[model samples]
Target: MKQMTRRKWLRGMFAGGGVTLLAACGGQPSGETTEEAPAADDTAADAPGVVEETGSAVTVTYWGSFSGDLGEAEQAMVDAFNESQDEVVLNYEFQGSYEETAQTFAAALRADTIPDVVLLSDVWWFNFYLANAITALDDLAADAGINFADYQPVLLNEGVRQDTHYWIPFARSTPLFYYNKDIWSTAGLPDRAPETWEEFMEWTPQLIDGDRLAFAHPNSASYVAWLFQGVVWQFGGQYSTPEFGMTMLNENTVRAGQFYGDTTNTMEWAMLSADLNQDFIGGSVASMMASTGGLAGIQESAQFEVGVGFLPQEANFG
Candidate 1:
């Protein structure tokens, strides 16, 4: 597409209200396609400039997953886009977590009732693609003047399937190791992150006492499985092969599982937490593996010094 500053294109995306679907249905033949023109944002009907400048501005309905501080930030972005110009206004609606958003979207597909834009997590996008419910973004992106070259390859490439772009990266994140620096100092451990899981194990006894955890594990809904993916990779294992072959029964996978099992059920230094971030902030746990997306919020909320490090290595770093 045309060369433009990233800032301008980002403004262009939300200004149209549907970065993912606003310039949609590219490559798909016209006539009888499932895609539809974006409906206008009603909340902007009473806003100034919209009626005076353009009669009716383009409105892109968006569904997303974010609440509390994150949600407020998301709203700020939407508001900024709406106020940036009178040509378009983003109508963002919170649909709970990524999984919940996907679930509602699945239902919308069946009912033929859908939003113009959606925030799809990496894993959820593929499901919609497989169902033939989403369109390739190549043509639409071109029409929208998006510069694929500007995006990080690792971030941009994840959306490719059959040589076409079906998803785009926006809010991407990965697991980060968050530790309580006060706890670490009091335990007399080194200030830096542990070099390896073995080393962390050696230090765990020093951190834990009287039901306090050296580390805490999140529950499944908090994305325990996603967090565990890092550990699996650190142990030099994978959940599956590229072609979707199961690898959970493999030796390295088994070893990873065993190590996790031992942490909670055998070693007694870590335990599964109801809320990993809360537990860590409340001083119930010394460390945890949580999304980098949460780091800012954690830092704002925690009473103690919060330190982040690379996830301690196992057989290899994830």
Candidate 2:
């Protein structure tokens, strides 16, 4: 196996947050005690008991889709936690990416191997909650002395069903604007990005001439849904009810559809691409909408000058 570098190890460790290390005694008698053994025993008494375990050792089997440098960072977190204090031992498992982790947990719940904790994509928390696969941590929170008021109410909210807090908000991401400055300058556009959605739509036409697309992929329902929500809110529309039972597809929905659909249909600004990064790097795409997590990756991979901005919105939604 390839060895993870020291820097990568440190990064992975902090990123994953839950990590552990175990130490072994070398041929010492079972009765013999190390100087710190008493402290370790005391610490173990306070930790949460693992579902599969009979005793104090909390083997928190966590699955995540942390790959590449990010994966290494998570491994480092695991190793650090295991080496920390010997109270909770986190057994890290690489199930695959965020989507894969969700899928794996879905399948695994049918079996005997139920993990104590699982990392899931923030959006997909709904699926887990709907299926009743995740434990409601409200009582756990109370027991642990966590006050919900201490955090942002919106941030703490995972898509709830019927007034039940199914999953505590884990990893979160927001949309962002990514543009190639070189492409923009070459195309004789403004130095900075458009401030409004209308402005952006208008600007797209002048940027593209032939097969080169003004924007990247436009196929992802998730991405489109996000934009639709944001845009509709900009124009004053409620996406879903507080109970989330009914979707309000009013005039705002029609406007959102028209605006988003025009990216490919009317404006011809975007290409129907799955390999957005490829198109961007190849200089075929001038700009794109991507997740906040993609910032570092885009910066590292793109050869051209990349500019970042908040997701484009209407004039006065906020």
Best by lDDT: 1
Per-residue lDDT for 1-318 in model 1, tens only? 222332344334433332352211111111221233223343321111111123455555688776777679889988876776765656788987666666787676655656766776665455565555564566556656676887778767767765877676776777778899999999999898887999999999889978788999977556677778889999999998744578999898889999999999988899898777789999998999888877888899999999998898988897
Q: Which ranges of candidate 2 are over 4 A from the true structure? A: 1-50, 54-56, 159-164, 221-223, 315-318
* Candidate 2 lDDT tens digits, 1-318: 112222233223332332112111111101211111111221111223233331644445666566777678879977986786454566788876555555666555544345556766554555544444454444444544555565446755544445544445433566667899997887677778678877877787777868887887544533445544666777666566765555566776567666667778877788776565667777888887666665777788889889888767774442
Model 1: how large is the Cα RMSD against the reference? 9.0
Give the best candidate by TM-score: 1
> What TM-score does structure 1 among the candidates reach?
0.80
Per-model CA lDDT versus the true structure: 0.69, 0.57
Residue pairs in clash, model 1:
none
Instruction: Tally clashing residue pairs in candidate 2.
Output: 15
TM-score, candidate number 2: 0.76
Candidate 1: segments with Cα more than 4 A from true spot: 1-56
Task: Provide the lDDT at 263 for model 1.
Answer: 94
Give one clash count per candidate, in the order shown: 0, 15
> What CA RMSD would you report for each candidate?
9.0, 13.2
